[model samples]
Target: GRNEKISAEARDAILARGEELGQALAERLPEVEQLLAMPGADQIEVGKKLRGQAQPLIDEHYRTVLRLKPRLAPIKAAVFPLKRNHDQLVATAKEVRRRLQLGSEMRTVYDDTGAIGKLYRRQDEIGTPFCITVDFDTIGQGKDPALAGTVTVRDRDTMAQERVPIAELESYLRDKLRG
Candidate 1:
């Protein structure tokens, strides 16, 4: 849903900007026939001067394009929760990787012995810089599993884990990914 919304917003902004630019260019440089064969050649000369002066306006418009369409830009960050079930985690991870455009192939390990260690190894093999494991601690505190609001994020390179609240997952991932 986020991906779809972002893409739509980006496309609309780009199309609107393109239309504006096209209109400006058409007004500035009319068809060659219109410019050379029109009755008022003197007016054409004035139009050319006016168009030259509008160049600055075009530049200004381009500068503010980001403000008009922010969703289409490259993602600044991403967050993923590693579920216990191998299939679920793999599926979720694949989706996150796809959404982030990471371009890495997904790999799975069948052995549960030292699973966390295996995950760390896989992360290194795939060049993933960070991994987050959603475990019992995340859903603890005598709360319902559905109500759990915490996750354990691990740095692939450092093998360090940190407890982060689920509510901050997006921003947290954004910051880590940006880094």
Candidate 2:
């Protein structure tokens, strides 16, 4: 099951950091505007420059929070079946949620291709970068656990899917989420 206490702390830290950064950006809006209007660079160049300047602030915030407590980062990915008729999908989602103690923030995508887009949007909104989906292809052709093997793990940022053995799912997710 989800660890309520740890999850709450993590959520609080993420929100607090976001608010702090928002306020800092607001205060610097004038300078940022000035920088944008200063030179011959195009909008894309200006954006790149701004992003370079902004990266350190983001890094600092991330480092501080992670250093303070690492478990606060929410689930970086989620997997659900497209069809509601599949009990496997529901069961997987429930288990994942319970294990992560994710509360109600986890999203379910009813369409396979659409899942990538939805996951990306959510990741942008919440600063996550990965999502996974278990489909018919994942279970192979067997109903038995011994026969059922690899699962499809999707990368949110790259939109890549690889067939990973079922036994490696948990550890793989942990490593990806940690990284």
Best by TM-score: 2
Off by over 4 Å in 1: 1-114, 141-148
lDDT of 1 by residue, 60-166 (tens): 33322111111222322224434546555445444444543443222222222345645555445545555555555454533556536566667654557887675
lDDT of each candidate versus the true structure: 0.45, 0.48
Q: Residue 40 in candidate 2 has what lDDT?
A: 26
RMSD of 2: 17.0
Model 2, residue 90: distance off in Å is 2.3
Per residue, candidate 2 scores C-alpha lDDT tens digits across 1-179 of 23333344554444344345445674565444444343321223324555566655543333321121112445455555544467776465445435443343333232334544454445444544444555555555346454354556666445577766656666676676556
Global CA lDDT computed for model 2: 0.48
- Per-residue error (Å), model 2, residue 13: 52
